[model samples]
Target: MKKSSLILASAGALLLMAGVYLAFFVAPDTVVRIDDRELVQFSQKIFYFHVPVAETSFVFLVLGGLFGAMFLGTRKRSYEQMSYAAVEVGFIFVLLVMITGVLWTRAAWNVWWEWEPRLTTFLVLTLMYSGYFVLRSSVQEESAKARFGAIFSIIAAVNVPLTFVAGRLDSLKPVHPKVFTLQGASMEGPMLAAFLVSMFGMLLFATSLYIMRLDLLRAREDIEYLKEELEVG
Candidate 1:
């Protein structure tokens, strides 16, 4: 990889570190609507980082799939490695998103795991993409593992949009109470700045995580190749 890409990866890691602090300490507090007649007070600040990170996770997930598809089309190992790294990082972000989302849902919606469209779809997406790893494990042959992993990665990518749309087909979409307003005093300047910082950090963290994984995978392949050569000699 170029020095610039390496710098970007390092920068992303630094951002993630900054994001964690901003998210926990700097955001505002507010009341969240749980149901038609119920409301619960929550830290208003988490919304900025939580919502943005969730969205960013999905974005990375899609990018992962795109790289996966590109790998298939070009039959280039680098693209394949990139796709694999993307999915690994995407998975980590998705898990974080799910955890934070569940906490928010429990406080706001009064349920641990609702069958709401987005939530449900995310669950499915998690399982399917995770299975991509399992599928790779089941194959013993080198070529077979790569081919299957690539194929499943593509399929999982295709399902993301489909699941997102399916998850939103419910009756209880976001109402007015949870919505932020400029005229109202919900989020002001300081809170917004903190929120933005947190978001940027999370995005940076995800990028760095992916870069690390990609390099690790490439190194593993190289080692495996050397081992085979040594054994043959």
Candidate 2:
């Protein structure tokens, strides 16, 4: 491995360990109550990972779109490769979001699922990116696949913003009361720290994943090229 890769791998592993420590040990407790009865305390602890993964997924979603735009502008395969990596990373984070969100619902809402806007939006996110992968696979030609996939990726990512907007358009359905409530109020100290740590950890993890995946992809491409050269020779 190159020195940069080795250094980054070491740093990423350290950060991942630190994040685990901060989350399990340093993070404060969360409590949920009804009529002065403590129904959930430590159960709410999962919120730290849930919200952060969900938010980090959003960051990657936008990043994929930006890379898609760059691919179109530059007509380069590298940008397409980077965009593909970002989308894959984004999908993993989205899955984490769904898993954590379900846990939170079971803990706080006493139900395994709810038709909340955020939840629905995340579901849409999963589908949109899934379509990206499908579209890529359907094309047999490499250059054509990359070209068309870039277009589809850009379009599919638009659903993210649309899904957010659609959530607001629905005024009648039951929505999570987030306006001026304790929910939206500034997160307290330990809670804030836990949240920040979770987000930063996931973002760093995603970055590391992107680098590793990209390197593997480039290596595969090089191998394929060498094989083709040998066959011709």
Candidate 3:
């Protein structure tokens, strides 16, 4: 592992632990009043992790798209490798978002799944990115594969914003909670602090993974090049 990635991974791990501690111990439980009765919602604690993972996924996906564009513009193999690595890391976070979301839904809504606007759109986004890998694998030529993959990555990244806004649209009537608005975050200070910690931790961790993946991809390319040279000799 690269030194920078190692440092990031270590810091990420420490911050994640601190975030968990703050979320459960320091942050106040959500309180809701119903018929003059107060109820504490422990399930709200999942917000600290769920929202962070979702945001991290979006960041990585966008980076993937940006790198993909760079690859297409310059025809640089390095950019292609970065794009692929970012997407792979982003995909893993997307899966985590889905899993954590389902768990949060089950805890808060008493149901395993819902056809809400946000959830539905996110599912579609997941499927779309999954097809990216399929597209890459189907193409035999290296340049053509990268070209198609870059296009698909860009298209999939565009969907990220749509999925984010799907929950906010008035027409959709989404059940997903809106924590942030033009005014500010709905969370109190401690909750926000915990969330921020977790968010940064998740981002750093994802970045480290991307760097590691990029290293692996470059190593594989070098191996292939050496093999080709040996065969030619």
Candidate 4:
């Protein structure tokens, strides 16, 4: 690994551990009214990680779309590779978001699943990107694969706002928090600090993964080119 990448990965790991420690130990517990009784539920600890993961997924989603558009406009292999790598990273984060969200909901709502707007839209987006991979694999020609992948990624990016809006449309009775802004956040001091720390760590982690994956893909291309040249010689 490159020195910078290694440092980033290490820092991200440390921050993640520290954030976890703060969330479970130092952060104040949330007191909620349950049937007219105020109760402190330890399960609220999941919020520290869940929201950060979800937000990171959004960052990757935008990057993937932007790179996809660049690839389509320039018809460059490097841009296409970047776009694909971004989507791969986004997919991983989105999966984390879904899993963590499910865990949070199960703890808070006491059910495994619900057809809530946000949840449903997120699942659909996940499926769409899963199909994006399938579409790429089914194509025999590289140009066709890149073109289709770029278009699909752009379309998927357009859907991100819809997913977010769906979540907020039911704000009056939203199961999820309406806003995560720090200025007027419902999350108090220590809890908010823990969440911010985790978010920063997760973003760093995602960036490191994206860079590492892009380097690996470039190396693989170099190897493939060498083999072709040797064969021709």
What tens-digit string does per-residue lDDT give for candidate 2 at 65-97? 889889999998889888888888888999888
Worst 10 residues of 3 by lDDT: 175-184
- Kindly list the per-residue Cα lDDT of model 1 for residues 1-233, writing each as its tens digit: 65655777677667656665655566545555546754435544457667767777787778877887887889998888897788778887778778877886776656786666666777887788779888978999877777777788888888888888866665676532434333336556666666666677667667766777877898998999999999998
> Candidate 1 — which residues are off by over 4 angstroms?
1-28, 31-40, 170-191
In model 2, which residue pairs have backbone atoms overlapping below 3 Å?
A: none
Worst 10 residues of 2 by lDDT: 177-186
What are the TM-scores, per candidate, against the unseen true structure?
Answer: 0.78, 0.87, 0.92, 0.90
Give the higher-lDDT candidate: 1 or 2. 2
Better of 2 and 4 by TM-score: 4
**Clash list (residue pairs), candidate 4:** none
The lDDT for every candidate, in the order shown, is: 0.72, 0.77, 0.86, 0.84
Best candidate per lDDT, number?
A: 3
Give the candidate number with the greatest TM-score. Answer: 3
Alpha-carbon lDDT of model 1: 0.72
lDDT, candidate 4, 1-233, per-residue tens: 98777888888888999999999989987777768998887777888898788888889878989999999999989998999889999999889878987886688778877667767767887898898899999999979999999999999899879776876677476364422232447677898889989999998888889888899889998999999999998
RMSD in Å for all candidates = 4.7, 2.6, 2.5, 3.1
